[model samples]
Target: MTRVVVHAGFHKTGTSTVQHALAQNRDALAPHLRIHLREDFDPLTASARSWSVTRSDKHFAAIGRNALRFFRSIGREDTRPVLMSSEDLCGHMPGRNGIAAYDAAPDILRVIADNARHWFGPALDLVIYFSTRAPDPWLRSTWWQNLRSTRLTKDLDPYADDLPRAADLSAVVDAVRAAVTAQVVTAPLEDSAARPEGPLAPLLDLTDVPADVRAALGIPPPVNAQPDLGMAEVLLALNRSGLDDEALSDAKRTIRRLAVKRSNLSPHA
Candidate 1:
């Protein structure tokens, strides 16, 4: 039976970095895993946010259908467990301006389960996986991450400590376990590079990367690791600037070029 492993993201726990790594290593992972990485997990990105925000079931049901279609498009005849990664899956998008969003909305999980069940038959089991970091660092990292990013909210105060703390994730964890009625693994975000399967292995319920395969394929450097502090500070200041949207976009390009040049010139860079 085919199963679904959902990486329902609690953002700022390196979701982008993980997704980047998987995309980069897709060829390497293909023999061991049948992965689906590009589904639109964020509801706000859909064309009908106002309507979706109102009819959550209908909104997520459509997402479930899309996911089913994607699964079939990948030649679903195989019995491989489907691995999916999406920080937006759980839909608890903490606004960039530091606001609390949903702490527990199991109905979204229910929507997916129901739709998937109907499409894939009742025997298809769905499970969830998540990652968390220490609260203080998680809060700070999230603030820095949202500086140049916007979706749920715009114009975060880059210099302020006014960002709200994420709620104890137990609230959502408990909700997910109840919603899915399946095993849920919560992995820590730190020191995961040392793991034999790397950080995402636990999500797939895998223990180790094959030694022979690891030897044969040289793993590339990470794709979307957090930028160094210097670059992050520069990006933050740029985000807080008075420039309009188009000008701000242009300024980001200019700033990135200048930073790269300075880095190359510096002996330590």
Candidate 2:
């Protein structure tokens, strides 16, 4: 039976580090499981757009096919664990705003469940692993990495914001949990860094790849990296500057174009 692990995130949660380590150490980890980064298995730059809520046909077709192929590969493999890492698996807009922000929670959850079921085949178990950051810092980190809009965030300090409404997390979790066997594991980034053995144990347990494999993959057993304060300052400045909707959209588009190009040009193969 093929085992599937979906590290659905609470984003800016060190997902990049996890994915990087997994990809880099593929050979060492290959025996226990094959790690599938979205683009490698699927030619489309799957995470280049918010696919769940994206309405564009071109985007949908490219992402959908890749998603299907991802599932098919898992089904065909004899591996003990097939790891799929995408922070987007968790609900986006983990806020109070309604569909105006993104698709409804249920719709997004359904799409994830459908993809997992299709890929893992019948009677699969699911785990939703996540990490926490104090909300303010997490949002600040998000703004930099995604290059979010100035206007939309004008009055708010992401760090000052509350932990996403429990109702919001619950609703999204329930939608996906109801369809499959699910468990929620939360690790605060700081704590995990200080005591990887404590907070990160569960993640390692779930993945069950050897320590050597983890080391080879460079999955730092949780280490501290400086929060790029300059990046955060620029993000905050963008919001404070108040670019209007059209300008913000153009900024976001330009950022995405560059990001996609960079992701495509990666030297790792």
Compare the candidates by lDDT and give the number of the best one.
Answer: 1
* Residue 239 shift from truth in candidate 1, angstroms: 3.6
* Runs in model 1 lying further than 4 Å from the true structure: 39-61, 71-76, 97-99, 151-167, 207-211, 214-218, 231-236, 257-269
Deviation from native of the Cα of residue 215 in model 1, angstroms: 5.4
What are the candidates' C-alpha RMSDs?
4.8, 6.8
How close to the true structure is residue 269 of candidate 2, measured as C-alpha lDDT? 14
- Looking at model 2, the pairs that clash are 71-119, 136-159
Which segments of model 2 are wrong by more than 4 Å?
A: 41-66, 75-77, 91-106, 118-120, 146-175, 178-184, 195-202, 215-217, 220-231, 235-269
Candidate 2, 1-269: lDDT as tens digits:
55566665555666666666665667776777767775555343343234544545665555556556657655454757767666555434333232222233334444555676776667666666666666556655544544453333433354324434422333445555554445555566667656434333446668787776654444443222223234334544565666776776676555444544554423221
- Across residues 118-158, which tens digit of lDDT does each residue of candidate 1 receive? 66675676677787767666665665556546422333353
The TM-score of predicted model 2 comes to 0.63
